[model samples]
Target chain A: MSERSPQRISRSALPYPYRADGLVFDVQAVLLDGEERVDVNVSRANRRWAFPTDDWERCRIVGTVELPSSVVDAVYPESERDSPPGSLYVTIRCRETIYRDRWMVQSETVEPKTYEVELELQRDGFRGEVELKPYLTRGAADQSTDDGSYASSTHARLASARPWTMLVDGEADADGETGLDVRVESFSTSPRLPKDGLYYLDMGDPSDPLIVVNGEHNRVVGVLQSEGSVGAEARMRDVVFDQIQYGVWSQLILHAGVAVDSTGRPQYDWQSTVLRIFARDLYGIDDIHAASRRLKRDLKDPTTVPEVMQRIDRVLQRYLRQREQLINLMEEGLRI
Target chain B: MSSGDVDTDDGRLADNTGTPLRTLTSEGRRLVDPAFLRGERTYADEVGQYVDEHTSDVHVELQGLRADLQAVVDSYDQYDSTIDAAAAPAVHRRLDISRRIAADPGVWHYLAVVEFPEFVRYRWEFNTETAMREKFLGAGTDIYSNALHRLWWIAELTHDGDDYSLTEEVLQKQTLANKIFDRWFARYRPAAVACCAKLVDESTEVAEEVTLRLNRVFSTRQLEGMDEAELGRLIQDLVTDIQNQGTTD
Candidate 1:
């Protein structure tokens, strides 16, 4: 690879769409005020960073994100109705990396019903795990919304009770494998996906084996729990079942937990929903109408490893033909 | 054929007649002032030694095709005077020279920029803004824009398997040549062949419309895995639509 730095062109200067071939990110900000979980769905999904040069190494990310209305309602003060509150502040952190400046919430709207509380950020960095945590300074408690309503002293949550969880939907790795891996689906994070690391898959079945990842030791140790005879084909089939469970169920859960970050649905909905349906059909899972809902309630309550894995098998059997066709397309799309 | 037997006399590269020639290094290619490329520095040794290292086997091949190239050059002034008449021989010479030698861009760059600096100067030799400099040096430049590279690529793209008749026909129409470089699909062998075979007898206007439509269609469609039959079907549909539109208008 050439040592040349990856060239970052503005969205306007792009020869092709940044979204079609650029890195896509969907950020979901979950505001937790004690047990009350207020989900703020924010999307900047349309922005794409295209590295046209061969041997691209890095690119600069420059974009703005608007905090959802739910976030504003969560932080608004009820005590003072006459005087508008000061600028609300929030800190967005991703894994170990944190932006130093607290993003101020501009309560005023340039247009009616469109309150602009946008965070303008510019960084030369790769997309990684991101977490947004909103903070209420002493001045922020007095801040007012555009309609000039003060927060009720009793109900206004001054600070984020817990870390805002960003749910990351999975992406197909066209450069390597086509579909998601079992470990990747389990550890899905928001903003950007982390490099594949260690994980544990506990099917919860007493007889089936457990897949465990020792992160510190950097190794995956599988323990066989079943004493019964297991054929080679049966074991291979088990592995495929685990992969489907991870790819379909885990991604479905993540999608349920978070909202898409783009202004509207992406043009390539076919790649996401249609293809995912096809994949699910391979395992005989046929809840197409339920899965289409933007937010799935089942994602909030955690399901056991055994149950999800079993669900994948059931779904794979439902739409065998479509699943095979999708797999063929994905295989053809694979370069290496 | 061996470069070992070739002379290192005064660090100069040589032609087939044992005349000392010039070659340029990769580094010299970047640092050589645009003014120098524009003929400000007329020193004989400017071409450098890279040419000698790479062109050992190509010496005889280049010699055989030299007369055909010179014929095209001789008729350069007659293009505007004769219109479509001058382009056929020129296209024929290009196909002949391009087929005779290896069509590596690096080799063509060396031949057009360094080996034949005098020829480059003679053609766009006096044009300002270092116009000839862009022709020799710009990376990812269309083969149509570069002096030697354009001729070779046109021949390579339009040739029908082993035959050069398709190449001659395509290049015979000046409008097609001008618009040909922009057709990204033409870079594909099957797509190029489909285009040549389909438009072999069409008028320049029809060819222009077809080329324009193909470019627009290719921009949005993921036509990578498409076979020649599929591409032929698509091209025929497009050509039919264009002819229908022309008649309707």
Candidate 2:
């Protein structure tokens, strides 16, 4: 009787993936292209986004798609029974919305006739926990589910089975969802750039702190983005990221300290938040008051400018744990 | 969620269209300057630089969408309710809705940068000045920020197959779209349409209250694993509850 309510249908009224005969995808194992075959956990499949750089390769999902003929008959209308009742196209779809590439190795129309699949995933920007499921699509071309049906896109999803998720663990540097937005930008266009260093932190946007990696020098976008991901360029990437973090922390702390000195506190909330979180995590400093106290006190010879750099270096040594991180950096070199 | 689009022509809109739908990484998204997004730079400006490192054979055509969007923005001076009502359906149809491609941050990034820079700039009010970075980059991930993506997603969620009535209703106010999208049921098409239907006609205060109540109900009642009968029953209960609140008021 409510005027606001529209024509209400029972929840089951609309066709909401309601199929009496649903198919299941039994993903057996994952194969590194032309190399090692890693058995899938059935629950979730995981392939590293981080391996070494030179040896990096694409991955493939190997599985069996099961659908009894009775299911095929029940779901699809008879060959002569209706108009263009499209074929059931089957494949594994990347359930991650953030991934750039969702193109699977293949998609196929599996009759009771065909069942096996060996689909490949293009190793471009593939990271994090990627959930893949054997999906049933209504239209588009056909082949074996994972084997021959590899395509970039598929049509209307007919049904979805229990999804299998995979965790591709990589280094900390490869994460994109961090508070600090680290980027690779060519500084040649930034005419007013004060420093043409390996990296520069653009602190203009008080809310969003940016770390611009100077592409003018090394142009190692891969090393920076990929880091320990599928292509493990571990040493150089780790050292670069470490140095960048150090610089960012030093500049921010210095800026916060200067702001507190002039006024009562840091000019921005982000400054306060970062000082509290990072300072606490990296150093033993707990509260903002303690941080404020620490920032005002200086290294020996407080009047001297280079002394600030000296203090930063001393803190960096502790944060980096001179022996630990540096040792990890050299472990790669020693391997070479 | 009903991806009814079939392949047309050389499969530009189809699943098999082997054209790579390019994307920019989160890091790459930061490199996108307001000037670059305002169509001041071409792909040669390295605006197309830092493309997601994918070897997928699929490629997407970076067609010019500036003139069309310029007309809309020039005429309306907004992501104005009027503009959204007209534009969402057009954009949805043009992109040839496929959830697989629709959900890719890279595809939206590519479109915003390589294909439709003006779309992002005009929508986010990039008038020779910087706008928020998330506005340019947050497609596919965030429900609200990305100008181009939210349009497609809005149209996708509300439109009954071949019907734009609900989409137009939701787009009647930007705030309403936010209310519908910011909920757990936003991804579920039926629930989204139901929520829009329930809220579209109510006063702003009443709608907001109902949505708040629904949010509380959703927190305790997970919608993910629920089937149609159960979800329908739950939604029906909310509708009755909303009617009672109307009576109370």
Identify the leading candidate in terms of TM-score.
2
TM, chain A, every candidate: 0.30, 0.39
TM-score of model 2 relative to the true fold?
0.49
Per-candidate clashes come to 31, 23
lDDT of 1 by residue, B1-249 (tens): 233335433233434543322234444454335466656774345444444454423233343234545565576752242222333344334334322133233455555566445545545544654455555653222444445555556665565555667766666665666665556566555677678778766777887888888766654332332346767777788888888988999
Q: Write model 2 residue lDDT over A1-336, tens digit each, in one string.
A: 332232222225224222322555566666666665454453343322333232345776677656545444543445511332223333222323333123232343445534676767654434444655544444332333323222212243444344455544332232222366667778878753555577788854433577888777764656666546322376666666777788787887676555443212443444565455444443355555555545555422367446656656677667656566567666654453
Candidate 2 docks with a DockQ of 0.05
- RMSD (Cα, Å) for all candidates, in order, is 28.7, 17.2
